[model samples]
Target: MSTKRYCYSCDLKNDSKLIAEYKAYHAAGNAWPEITKSIKDAGIVDMQIYLTGNRMFMIMEVDETFDPVKKAELDAINPKVQEWENLMWNYQQELPWAKDGEKWIPLEKVFQL
Candidate 1:
């Protein structure tokens, strides 16, 4: 099945120690299974996050049935997802130009092949 792709970016706190810890948490056999399952259940076919310095970029591939707003609503009601997000927030910071409550800001596609 063909999937839709979404890209987003966010910033991490400038603290080196915290950034290291955050990276460790996302390493193999470290990320919480519940969070991964939640994403899959939300129709996300695949997801990947890349980090450089204090910046983060994420790519998500989802099925045609995926609805970001609905997925967010579902996540909000899931305890494990909420816990994971809260913990992640400790190591993350809003972008300089982000509005209130925004974390990962969507990146517009300027070019596509």
Candidate 2:
């Protein structure tokens, strides 16, 4: 399967609450459905999220016909997706290396199995 990875760090404040919210959001499934719709609309395929310590990661299997730049452009104009992001941002903080409006950064893979 094709894969892509994204990584981001979170601020320590309200860490427990943030984790709880992440769990709850996933449990509800609506958040994920919304996200998957966005991805599919952008021509991407299956995706998943994982966490390790303070970092969050996303793995996506992009459609062979997907255009990454176009997908990003479409993502920028999606109001409902933006609304979801804004809600989550309530519990999110800018990481030390992040610029404004960036919640997660695309990570370069150094090694993989």
In candidate 2, where is summed lDDT lowest over 10 consecutive residues?
4-13
Check candidate 2 and list the clashing pairs. Answer: none
- lDDT tens digits by residue: candidate 2, 12-111: 2347777777657756455667676887876566766676654566666665667777877777788877777777777666667888877666776778
TM-score per candidate, in order? 0.96, 0.75
True-structure Cα RMSD, model 1: 0.9
Could you list the CA RMSD of all candidates, in the order they appear? Answer: 0.9, 3.0
Residue 82's lDDT within candidate 2 is 77
Off by over 4 Å in 1: none
Q: Report lDDT (Cα) of residue 36, candidate 1.
A: 85
Clashing pairs in 1: none
Q: Residue 103 deviation, candidate 2, in Å?
A: 1.7
Q: Which tens-of-lDDT digit does each residue in 6-76 have in candidate 1?
A: 99999999999999999999998799999888888989998999999999999999998899999989989
Model 2 / residue 30 / CA error / Å: 3.2
